[model samples]
Target: MIVPNREKQAKLRAFLAKEAHALGFAQLRVCRARDAQDREELLRHFINKGYHASMDWMEETLERRAHPSNLWADVQSIIMLGFNYGPDEDPRQLLARKDKANISVYARHRDYHDLIKGRLKQLSAKLLSRLRETHPEGAIKVFVDTAPVMEKPLAELAGLGWQGKHTNLVSREFGSWLFLGAIFTNLDLLPDEADKDRCGSCVACQEACPTGAFPQPYQIDANRCISYLTIENKGPIPHQLRSAMGNRIYGCDDCLAVCPWNKFAQQASEARLKARDDLKAPALADFLAMDDATFRQHFSGSPIKRIGRNRFLRNVLIAAGNSGLDSLSCDVMPHLDDSDPLVRGAAIWALGQISPDQDFAHLANQKQDQETDPDVKAEWHLALKGKTS
Candidate 1:
């Protein structure tokens, strides 16, 4: 005779490991939520410093974000899983061309959330099917970057990887290229061995940050982060960091792209998330021509659509400013009268860069009558004075 709890745990672990592999997970690990006080303290400190910027959602679900049991109540074991989205091409190559905008590797393909969530849901269904017979009363909930769970720390806890100094979960085998997902379950599965911290004396990610977004190791200032400023932020991008944004029109993966550990990441097994040729390094002139409908059509399944036409154009304007190509002066001119304030402001800033004195003056004169957005007006005033911000 064997202990029932041990047998149950063993059975559940074996079943989960098989199901995860078949469902396309790169790896799966389980752990009890024993300790998270330090992470909780860090979260509070992150809030105190306003490091999250305008992302009030992080503040809104503070309690549930810090604690696992608070989320599902009956979660006895936390299943932290890795979804590998290995880069199909050299990610850093896009940065070489001055006239081409560098879209992040992750956004070069179809959105990972949609693809990974669909797979996670399928895995959940399989788990429930197994539970109906063995652990009929067991409950499970899945989360993928949504919800309040401290996913990076939880992944670290469940032996998926150690949380790198960049605050992203990094595994020795998978590197930093893995997308994390979680399955909160009532079944008490045997916990996996925790991953050890391997980022010793390494500061590659820190030095890679263009805007100095990392104030110290293991922390990121959301306000200066190109990813947060481009994707998450809804208002005007700060003047200082705009120029540092370079040609990265979507998200910045400089820190991740520079990681030495990514050398070991396997190319994505999911073909749908593979990089599209057209998206790799698109011409800025052609990139500027996309209106909302065209933008939606081009980036339908891609993550670039999250920023919409105006914000995307705002990023393009900064890229245009950095381009040093007089040819794009005409391209940036029409945006002086853009419907969105952020776009108009970015246009003003870009025009002051490449525009010959005559064309810029004419643009300022032409848009003077129609412009009412205060921010745009301020930018227009600044541009006429031959100032570039």
Candidate 2:
């Protein structure tokens, strides 16, 4: 059981920071892996209140995710990394362009898990090599959101930032635009001072939520979250929430974009994380026309690709319906007959919104007789009655 001296540990920490910055990470800090008791209880409270929505995995991984030692018994330190993915402009600006799709700023480029995981592995390897010189038995493991790690809480404990009222980590330097990654190690390391909550008297994020996802300060109901509805949710968007979704075809950024701390946010230094020109406010008509092949090809390396064509088209149809562009009614009509019942249901609702009432009644009359799926039929029933919710 060899332990590195204080001077040696301090030198290693300095080396880790320098290398992390060189790799384009915005912030790096560490904390004892055991410093996670409070977060574990908070996670339990969130799950007990059903705030996790349909993401059952959160409950399934409760024990393993509660603390770092529960994940790896030998782990003694946790290193948290933050990368800035701040948008060049306010993402809320695109919401008014009803004819164009409003994609969340984070999903406009390459998938971040891939980008961050690759960098984490690189940093892990470099650190491992250095560790071998002092303690050959020392080992490290890296995670980038694919695992059950409580990254935000661990990051907060590591002095990266405090979790804002929106339940996302908020940084004084980068605001709500930081992408977090973690590295667990067997060697004990000096820990940084924890970042205290800086959200004093600010409910800007809460007020900005279009869905009113927050029931109280520092709490969220994922069932009403636009981000969860558009991304994690596998079924049709709730009828009542659809009208409020507006032109957001992918994940929503309203809460994050409105954070006051973002005034100090910097443009993403990593080119791959920056928004692509074509994805920045793409025409709703164009996305509504994408088939499986086109959607796959267009979003080849993007995070949006993971949601699949049918779901993507479903979101686009909701936007088209909300757009009030009668020109898009023709585009929405095709999706009404889509193979996926989810798409068909959303399309029915969209057409009912953009199409003439008489025309929609005529189409509903013709299609209701042929529709077999109970949910799709329900959509037709609701839409024909001129119901937006």
Could you say which candidate leads in lDDT? 2
Tens digit per residue, CA lDDT, model 2, 78-175: 98999999999999999899999999999999999999999999999898888776678878899999898988888888999998998899999998
Weakest 10 consecutive residues, lDDT, candidate 2?
1-10
lDDT of 1 by residue, 162-224 (tens): 988888888888888898888887766678888788999999999989999999999999999
Which regions of candidate 1 deviate over 4 angstroms? Answer: 1-8, 35-38, 365-370, 386-389
Q: lDDT values of the candidates?
A: 0.83, 0.90
Report the Cα RMSD per candidate: 2.4, 1.5
Ten contiguous residues minimizing lDDT sum, candidate 1: 1-10
Q: What is the lDDT of residue 172 in candidate 2?
A: 90
